[model samples]
Target: MQARDTTALHTAAATQSPEPGKKRDTGVRGTGTQIALARSETPAEGTRHLTGSRILCADLPRTMARFTTGTLSENRAMLIATEVQDLGQEHRGWADEQLTLNPEDFAGESRKALGDRVRALVQEIEPVTALERIDDARSRRFLRLIPTGNMTMRLIGQNPAEHGVLMHQVLSDLADSKTAAGKGQGRTREQIRADEFCGLVTGEQNISPRVEIELVMTDRILFQAEAEPAYLQGYGTIPAAMARQLVRGRDMELKLMRWIRRTGALDLDPRPDLRDPGLPEPGAAH
Candidate 1:
């Protein structure tokens, strides 16, 4: 998974067991509010946040899995973020238990903090849902994209030339995803989308994605992008300049080009075994 530091306002479930130890701590921008010293409602004590494996559960009253108890209060808490979605963790809202949201102020927290880097995404972890529009559900159509650096490119059409574009978009999406999540295509599908992606990117440290790329491939590379042009996750179709950049000085036989389509499926098949090839050139890093 790539590192993703999206500005979000997450609401903890009131149904969750009181934070362990139930002690109070001061609240900051990223950290939860300081509980401020207090007594526990029960026998449990020394309750700190339980950083565990994330278990996504939409429409779940128990969005928070399990953490030992800390203390209890008269419902006094602090703001965590701007992603105030209903059951959904990514969809954000304003009014940090104080402020209200204006139409133009959508993604306000993330914009103020991470800006263009934090994309508004509603990924389907389980049930496949019909994608909706950012502004209004009236336009419930899904948009194709290719993520590059800070922004995303919209995949408008398809063609052979589009394939080159698609390849670029997918790579950008993958790269962004990797940088955000800390995992890559080398990992299983599930492992690639874990919460670690968010922890590594913006929330942890702000690193510029634009620089250079150097893939040290010791074997032949089967690089088939969208044959016509395909849509990326947060980004849209691929870009021509990026595609042109990928085929630098590699052997002609090592690269495979194809046409990608807008609604086309990807070929995630493994590359064929290559004969013993010399060490790949260690190119410059961006």
Candidate 2:
């Protein structure tokens, strides 16, 4: 990776060569020296960038072995190196060994799928670190609402990967509906989803058809108006008020539902559901 970064630097230098009799810019691409410069320039963020770059630098030889011999494509090699770049040196060696020794594992696979596999291996190599990182990330979870001009806004939310996939499945179902496919309406599926999003959030349209949104909350949260939060399955956590309002004045049936975690294990106790005649929650109770 150092060589690759240096090659990039050299290519840029050549492209910007000075005219005759003009002094050229002298820039050193020494590995550690550049990392120090990077840190000084952007103290808060650069250290992380440089450290990641250093890992890739150390792993480049093995990456090139895969690249040069045609066992992995250039992109896949970089993807694997980047995914596990923060792993400990010993674990990184294990990752490299896996890549080289098990070429068939990632051969001819999609980049996204291959990246996932590589990351999973990294988790295997250092499960404790992986879990700590996951918890740290969950602590930083947030949702952003950005308003575009012309009265439109963008909504972005960060959640667990499982919740993300479940949310996508629901929106996709709505976006692909026949009703959403308004004849000669001239709206793209994305635009339809936008409209559907507005409708659903504003209580104008139902979130799902045939299926009801299951609401799971403690009795205290539901009946006593407690400040505690409620679980909304594919939607992750929601405010207790929202969950209460959804069930207020409605006939809801309480049922025992199984709660499953990302690891494919069920919770010890069966989850309690507050299901109205309306749509049941898309996925399992959170």
Candidate 3:
């Protein structure tokens, strides 16, 4: 199958077991083995190329078929295949099923669309496990203040995706209002937003709008420990752990949604209480 990294592909093929009496190429390193072969090369670069092919052939065989058939580009095939490599076996299977069932949807799509579609389909490899991982990752969130040479300071913020979107929307709204009021204003939206941000931060403007965030989660995920990610409004989907954090200590009302198995429609759960007598306790014996 074709691969994003030709060097790695040839390397892996060269390393395959040789026919009887024919010795494997031990004297020469495979293209995939470049990092190990050369002292100057970084391991990460080699790993990316090497793992790309392995992921395609082993984890996403159907994608490999498409690659060999010239239906998918090497980069796109590698992109889709490697994305599921982090998922658990069950989640990987789900992703594979989606790809197989809807081949037409992925054909000739842009790289970003392909990535977003894959993320939408897979949700999380293992939501509970992924939640734990996101907790660990949260520690890395930060804000940096850098002073540029031109007497200006740059503010770099690294926040949760939902919060970032909220801030952007607020600033964009202020900027839009300012621009609309001024008839021949030539300032771009980006410039207006920057000025509005300065106005808010410097106490020139006192606008405190309550940020509204919407979360969509399955009942199984909310109370039964289902391995499904949560969808955050205005920010697409996020890990369930992040969703939990977003709602923690906040005054909010819960709305239950029931999935009609027959029609595949999501409707409001009429039952106020979430408890089900027929369902066994998590660890209870069948």
Candidate 4:
């Protein structure tokens, strides 16, 4: 569908006339096709999808045939497409033939295995292009935080394999030390490593004196031991008991501000301000 849309847009643009000194204006550039397809959210995501679609439609007939026949998955097809993109048309077609020659060979292959095979083939076919692709990949390394439910977040990143291995080793060593010292009792090595990573990044174990973490909840949840959950800003909903534990564990000082009512909903300011004495400080003794 995306390929068809792209081709139709290109044909339509080719027939249109340009202004005096300007190029013909076509909306199907960059993420325009992605938006038209409504398949991806970001431009990078859209471009990746479109690139895969174009490569399969225009360059890899055998692979496309497998994809159409449900023998190959879209993800694996896209992986192959992306791997062969830097090759010349003739070489790209050769790669397509080499990869898809044996349909039965892909039956139980994992995506990682398929990707590694494609990469190895690309290296054997053209070493210079393979090196260039490696450099390009290195230049595009990034880290992003994705919020998961239950007041947790997922940290996703890409880095050189060496650096990643070294970082993992360091975290493992720290976790082991904590385990030996009986500091992280009852926690798994993975959990301790995660805690150590957070401590190292946030300086919570060393330099951080007092960090402000926000937890918003209703008056009943905060004071009356209600069952309602509290919202931890930047994370997600956490149990009322967990929220109270955070305040009590951190020895946080709480000051109650004015209760603003809007549209029959009460808004409580969770931020602590020393000057605001509208209500007495709530005891964190729950």
lDDT of each: 0.28, 0.57, 0.62, 0.66
List where candidate 2 sits over 4 angstroms from the true fold. 1-52, 67-74, 104-107, 180-184, 209-256, 259-286
- Candidate of highest TM-score: 3
lDDT of 2 by residue, 1-286 (tens): 4435644544465467576886564432233355446446444333344444445556656766666677766556657767787687888877777766766766567886776667657655665566566567656878889999898788987865434544566666787884545641787777776777778778898656433455567655543445555556555444455555555522223332334233333222223353432333434453
Better of 2 and 3 by lDDT: 3
Listed in order, each prediction's TM-score against the native is 0.17, 0.54, 0.64, 0.57
The candidate 2 region of ten consecutive residues with least summed lDDT is 249-258
Task: List the pairs of residues colliding in candidate 3.
Answer: none
**Candidate 1 residue spans exceeding 4 A from truth:** 1-84, 88-121, 124-267, 270-286
List model 1 lDDT by residue over 1-286, tens digit each. Answer: 0001111111333323455676333222222222212223221211222111111222111212111121211111111221223224333221121222232333333432222212222222111221232213323434355666666443443333223334444445556667667656476544443433344443653433332222221111214322222223333322222233334423223244322222333233344332112212222121
In what order do the candidates fall by TM-score, top score first?
Answer: 3, 4, 2, 1
Tens digits of per-residue lDDT for model 3 on 152-220? 889897776655667777886787677778932788888888877888889998985544455677656
- TM-score between model 4 and native: 0.57
* Model 4 CA lDDT for position 280: 36
Which runs of model 4 end up more than 4 angstroms from their true locations?
Answer: 19-22, 30-37, 140-157, 173-183, 188-190, 199-286
